[model samples]
Target: MDNNFLPISREDMQKRGWDQLDFLFVSGDAYVDHPSFGPAVICRLLEKYGYKVGIIAQPDWRSTEDFKKLGKPRLGVLVSAGNMDSMLNKFTAAKKYRSKDNYSPGGKPGRRPDRATIVYCNRIRELWKNIPLIIGGVEASLRRFAHYDYWSDEVRRSILIDSRADLLIYGMGERQIKEIAAQLAAGLDVRHIRDVQGTCYCADNLDHLWDYVQVPSYEEVIASKEAFAEAFKLQYLEQDPIRGKTVVQRHGDVFVVQNPPVMPLTTAEMDEIYDLPYQRTYHPVYEKEGGVPAIQEVKFSIVSHRGCFGGCSFCAIVSHQGRIIQSRSHESILREAKLLTRLPDFKGYIHDVGGPTANFRTPACRFQTERGACKGRHCLGSNPCSNLTVDHTDYLSLLRALRSLPGVKKVFIRSGLRYDYLLAAKDDEFLREICEHHVSGQLKVAPEHVSSKVTRLMGKSGKEVYVKFMEAYRRVNQQLGKEQYLVPYFMSSHPGAGLKEAVELAEFLRDIHYHPEQVQDFIPTPGSLSTAMYYSGINPLTGEKVYVAKDQHEKKLQRALMQYRDPKNYDLVYEALVKANRQDLIGYGPKCLIKPRLEQDRPEVSRKQRRLPVSRRRSAKRQRANKR
Candidate 1:
């Protein structure tokens, strides 16, 4: 579990003849093998490029002593902090946001720095001093700002400055990583590596750096919430290593930084990366000794694709993967599946496939190195253009091929694949295949919010889109003769949502008789566009007008919406309605608190039993049933 106790040491590097190493990948969390994606994939890709890479997973990164164990490398280090789990304050906000909704004792689940990455970076800075530490991944990528910190409950600076890393590469690093390696291999110093796309590093003089991408400053965003909200389709500002500056931008904010991908993987190169021999275990060696469950116990999932054209604000995929959809070839997927089947505990099903917003196999439109086609940063944001290519043909073909492979029974799309994109498909064959084979009895979908205004602010489609998707889902299920239910995911207490909107949502739920078993209160993870809105009550990148549900009372009303079906919540709902002065919600309304209120009123009536009319008292049973 600890890097110090790791069997492999510097001596092992010497024994393996790995001198003048090409890459040193410092992983921030526990190591996972079988799924074989993320930083691990990048590591394998570097090996193919003839680089001797060392993977240090889950280092106790608190001190410099542990960092010195790993010998120095000729090339700069590759750092990835993984993705955000949850924001502490966002979780706290959820408690008040949905006071009626029962939550676990501790609070909403949130995440902090992975012990390995945090400790390793601190130590790496102490030991290596000036050596380059190129940081990437969701955790490191998003926290490049001085934003609200829920745990300590305050605003903090960028992780790059905190960790003291050299270069910060946001988004997918396949293309960027290759370019960084090639430049270093060709004897180009890290100081002159400004041309690389999807990368951010510090420089002494800001003007000299490739014209600083024109993104709104944090101060501007904090001042005008609306402008910040409307700025970028996705906003994640990383810290520049050289100048100690930050690379911040709005999703659709401005056209400042447009550095093209240095080496966007072609279909063939993607094939090569996925085809690498992956053990596919979180701890590959541990599985053999029964330290963990075998594949038969838990199915391994892999991502055949990344990115999405849909620019829904609630989603961070477009910001992370960009609007361009990149994919792994069918051949590569099949090979990996075959390898899974050959494993000792191989099951007849491929657990899941896809990433970011899965099913988005290619760009929404023809992507060019010259002028970009995706003006909105999300395909679903504004309408798709005439040139926009919405094709499920290749993706469907990949799905069918994987199912045809031996030892593959089911291939689930566990990741959130945009329903809008799936709905855009002209043919029903893919949907049919999915309904018949891919789905379990319960299917998961994220409709986020139902209110149009809230949906707009959250950067998601309104209730209508979700309704249409539901209809489509039913049609498919009926055609397949399968009894499946779509489990819809909804969010409460977002930046712009208030009590009125929450009550409206409750009414909407009442009308549809849709009572979700689980409701998520919004958690603002680092590097997300919405985080800015939640923190500053404004959009940082663009100076647009925006609303934020930051008040504690406002959050409570939103939480009340989720408990409409429970009678125990009557008093709670009644209080919320009374406080809001919304008498309309008092009786048989979505915000009705009559059940508990009536029960409470019963005790007082019991004390005055003799005052009740005999006839009225006899009919009390009938009255209760009718009211209920």
Candidate 2:
């Protein structure tokens, strides 16, 4: 496989080479700083190792022309299985839109460019049938088996089969990708690269293989998309040969093999990766086509850490970044901050410096060597773990240090800081420092739901905990004479939040005068335990029955409670209050709640003539009584 198939920038080709190359990287995402997507970073890393590399980005490689334009390569890497579901959803959505009798009302579902990976992989196969086409990233990696497709609601086979990729690399790809590039650079052939950790390849013959293999029953997975997604989730476990857990898969005549797991990149590797000379300005390529970026101008979100220790059921950080909590040293974060400040468009404040559960520092517990096991590294299943080392003294120190640096006037911890964790700050002085310095007007925290049952399901901090913390926070702010506000992030229609619970939550919000600034509807992002629960109504972790409010009307009512003060939404809130069986909230909702319209006074004869429904008639009667 020659690397020249990729059409490189003419300037880059003239400058970097005597041009025959060892590798070509292709991705469906715009190349950005940090290695969120595998092929993008892998291409940069190959260049670092002195190999000629070309990138075919956001390509629609559906035809032989797309492949020829990409150029033939010694090795080909297809890195998309994009950030969302497989591509079939687009066709499904388009078909739905075209067939709609009415112009399909307001919300159109989003779809992934699924055929990107399929087209690219199939085209590469056409160009050189046996060339080593390594497919990885979320799309290919998770699809490396016969699994459920949520969009299509059907069982689908490995992308390696569909896209015809030579191998599938799953999980964190830095170490595995680096090793792959190094091997190719050293002229090692692809066949001999067997059992490489974090690598999956199709192969022949599993009959002769030893060791216990857990091949999930096709029927069990096909029972439902949720069932299949659950089985698939469990199947993608970390393997450390040194730790003695490796999975091997046999695919027809070819075998998909995995090496002992590679420890995810440490903080230093993350720093080096982030330090890549990326043209950080938002490339309005989508905007050029008159489309907006899914996220507009999040120029401030630089990752200071690569992973998280929190295993909240509602989160995918643990699965995607792993629970390792690898963090860049203070110097690296400061350097990035300084660079951002120095940018010609220099914004004074750095938005945030953290990853999942931002305030949670690495090595959550000091007890790392109990019987040579890290007690803190694995907190996914354990909630409010006793060993949680959430002290913010170090984080506070980091924030203060950044604030004190040259060219930096302020540094806000705008990223999520776990309220429960902050409440547990070992040092009150640090808490005070956070209140005084870290927060700019408002501090955000995810007290996901007000209900304790929902909190437990979400693996989130409870409402009472947040209440207690809020009281303490108010006192601290008052004592310091600072008018800082606590911005609570709430989620509606999560698992177990039935109408009754939703009503209870609405009333709770009313009582506290705590109408949240933002109410997030449960989105059910892929690969998270919550997504499984949302899809199946059962917790994948506990296998316990869970209640998820999937009804659109119920979700709207709960969200409307968060905006009870808006005059335009008053009637909606009142109706929601009635439905939630919390009519008490109509008069005594949030202190700022708007008043609803009252029915005009009418005589008995006129009321009889109106012939309203019993429910509406009762509501009108209640309105008349309230006026009296």
Candidate 3:
């Protein structure tokens, strides 16, 4: 199977002696056999378990001909809008057309249409009116419920409703997919297949369901911001797999019921999924016009784990991957690294050996797996939880093994490593290991902001934790006789951050003598808490007002402050300093973010200087000008 991708054409399907495929996997991305693609994983998993699956990658959505190429699937059709939301993949944050798509062959654009899941499914249903359509992946999963659409600037109904998908499998879908496949194989009707966890479906009535909580209807949430906030809070609370209950929200006459998320896979299960004979590269079909560009970064990488516990306010990991961390076993990881060394393109370097948060290799607490994550709090946010399980022994051991593998020169932790977790580790062995062996040059960590108000709103630890982490990182590198550095990543114009907080972050950057080359302006991607705030100007959790930086000018100013040392940011930074009433910072003081304009560059100063006698005017010149 390594020599071949899953059958993408009818001839290839016949070559495998298949009369018809058990499923036809339709994706908005070109066919890539790598495990990173959801279509590849689900299709390959189905094949591994003896269900014939064929793929139709990026079918022409305008008509039914391309979908007809694969013929109707025997069991069902699985649809995904590539690896990202279609709207996001096609448009920039500024809503301009993107000319290239890494997920497409040759980095081509317009291969897949907007709202791909809905478009693809509509075509499929037109060709085969009653074929079961199950939609999953980022687009379907994040839009499983009614969500705020930044692009449309309106609240949209559940994607399940929009795509008319019979069922939606959300989150990382290994467990849910396997279970759903078995039930469907047994000849279950899509309408009656409601008991599966980590799934959502719609119905006209909900009398048959049990242990369900009803949230605000779609009409109410769309009509009122208050109702939207209330509904989102309830959805956020019950996301844990262990303790969550089935939740139902009314949309007109239809009831969209979401079952509890699928339980996180154990180490062995994760190992099996990754171990499935993945070719670990894009299919050869894409070799002509240059292979898929996205595979370049990941072909040499390993996904060491799934899920995250950091639960940043701006991130949607809590909703998508859940807060309970699930890692692959150390031996499983070592085996994969050894395989990477065997690849034709093998270099000595392994790009990354981590996922989501690189440092999280286990659950945050003893009870997080059997029970669920705690309510209204996180494992590491604002402050470490008293009961938090802070250890890095397993991750450290895994890193050591990969580096020791023959022909392996280096293994880097390119994924985001939670700095607060590093600070909370009771023993410093793991921190020491990363500093001594793994860091390529400078370790990147996200403190997000220094202002406590802003950090709290970002669901980040206080500045003191970042301060301690920085000292420890420096000390470890210094003791090891290494000249490595730390690159602190910050976010600007978050929900609670006003001009004051922006200036506070700028001051922290000044204190550290660091200037980020680029700063991320918070984009309100669907399903994030920060997006909820962006849409409603209200924190859903406490129902308190939040200051949203929505004005384009303010967003630019906030972003400019992050890179204030850049000469191009002078005007925006000046605006921020003045607006925050920190005009004292706009001068030539050592702490000033930027030097004040020269006398001639300022109209007032130049006018005053010109009116004075030559001797007096010379005093207004830059002091060192004549000396130089």
Candidate 4:
């Protein structure tokens, strides 16, 4: 193997002067030696701790031949379904197969199968039945519990039970993987390794379990929607690392026990992980195939922090990365930026400097580090918490420092920026600085929907907050003599969004005279509160019933309303306006969403009007108007 990358083949292993590997990582994505890729991070971390690691990227699961090529590892095998969920990466919100997979070589499809973690593990088992198999990554972490699967439209068993792996690491696995490796190297049996934090393992019974919260069994959740909601609520509340307890759920005779999440890394720990010796690009083997397409966006980006406190229900960040923020020191980020300047393709532009939510450099409040995030309360929900700390001094300083670096012309904040948090800050320096230096031609923000009812269910601030932010943004841009615009992101067919609310959003867009180029239809991916609501027709946090657009046609109508100005969407928009009892909005007026159909084209027009000639119809209408 080249000293720059982990061994990929037996030949590479020979070149590395190694007879066998300590750990072999099998991923559903092409090998990209960058920190943004989860598999790469885990492999590099293991290698840093003195383990001989090799990667087998996107191995063929159709047969056992590819699984045996890596040979049996001395320690165990690590499996991941790449950076995204397998089903989500393969299919669209409409449940149609996508033409391409960005993570695959040359952006081609079918390189990885659906439910990749399960398939890969099955193939590995066929080759060696007794090897220790550990699964992690976004796919495994989000589906750790018995949760809703959008593609299957059913509540499924825990991934730990389904994959039949000895261990499943959830969340960020740096802390858990290092410990597991040490114990395994010490000759501990995989079956007996059940106490690691941030991991889940199956048990035959509860004989060794304690201080755990038992959720509804798999059968109960499958049998009843209320039970499913109850189970999701319990799982959601206990995700905190400080106050969280071990979560246990029953699947047939087997019990899947999940230990409390690993603590958020400190600044020093976060710096160490990002400072690993990464080649910072896709493996050379993929060069003939034009490289993995997913690297384009992240290749020049810097992850300044991890985790989010924005608390949007439709997002899975809180579920996977936890709400506690873990940020890298400014020195570490500068080092990475300096490295980017030396790359052969350096273009004097850093794509982004943010994570799940930018401008969140610290915990939501001072108490989150000592006590866990408060249960059942959001820091920046519709009503901001009184104790929430809204500050951007540190993030501003980092941006200023990066801008001052040599050969760096610009640094943008492309990640989701919580506008409500920005508006809440005591001073406007951060906002002013962003408007002056950070923003590109247009800034992208997520207002989601204008209706208060929908925003409330989304765990977002109301429309009034968005309106306030918009006004403030415009004022700041005018002061800076910049003409930047806001490209607000809107969603369609989310839970609690009926035709009435959809029409309201359409009207809001109409009044603004801005039509969105694209609309995001809600896809109920696993491990999100919105998906639970879509499955059970009830909000898990609160017991209130919510309206979900499950039928394909209704979803189409909702999506059309977001882009009502499109000529192709006229029919769907007209149907939605009538169904919403807002027919007044479909007329020849300045505020009308669509023009009235010609008399001859209107099937619903009265037969009397159709029977008269055009000239006579005008005369009759004038006579009737005079008489009235």
Top candidate, metric lDDT: 4
Candidate 3 on 568-607: residue-level lDDT in tens?
8888888888888888897757988876665326664555
Candidate 3 error regions (>4 Å): 597-628
Q: After superposition, how far is residue 393 of candidate 2 from its true place, in Å?
A: 3.5
Error of 4 at 62 (Å): 0.3
Residue 615 lDDT in candidate 3: 74
- Best-first order by TM-score: 4, 3, 1, 2
Candidate 2: where is the Cα deviation over 4 Å?
1-11, 33-40, 61-64, 81-112, 141-148, 186-192, 207-215, 224-233, 236-244, 247-261, 282-301, 366-382, 516-518, 564-628
TM-score per prediction, in order, is 0.81, 0.80, 0.95, 0.96
Q: Give lDDT: candidate 4, residue 566.
A: 94
Q: Per-residue CA lDDT of candidate 1, range 289-355, in tens?
A: 3443223323457668765656666556544665555678777778777777877776677778876
What global local distance difference test value does model 1 have? 0.61
lDDT of 4 at 116: 96
Better of 1 and 4 by lDDT: 4
**Could you tell me the lDDT of residue 551 within candidate 4?**
94
Estimate, for each residue in 1-628, the C-alpha lDDT of model 4 and write its tens digit: 1348878999888987889899999999999999999989999999999999999999989998887786899999999999999999999999999999999999999999899999999988887799999999989999999999999888888888778899999998999999999999999999998888899999889978768899999999999999999999998999999999999999999988999988999999999999999999999999999999999999999999999998999999888899999999999999999999998898999999999999899999999999989998999979889999988999999999999999999999898799999999887788899999999879999999999999999999998998999999999999999999999999999999999999999999988778999999999999999999999999999999999999999999999998998989988998998899888988767888887667526655467876778798778778878998
C-alpha lDDT values of all predictions: 0.61, 0.61, 0.87, 0.92
Looking at model 3, residue 52 earns an lDDT score of 92
Q: For each predicted model, how many residue pairs clash, with residues at least 3 apart or on different chains?
A: 47, 29, 0, 0
Please state every model's RMSD to the true fold in angstroms: 6.8, 6.9, 3.4, 4.0
Residue 161, candidate 4: C-alpha displacement in angstroms:
1.1
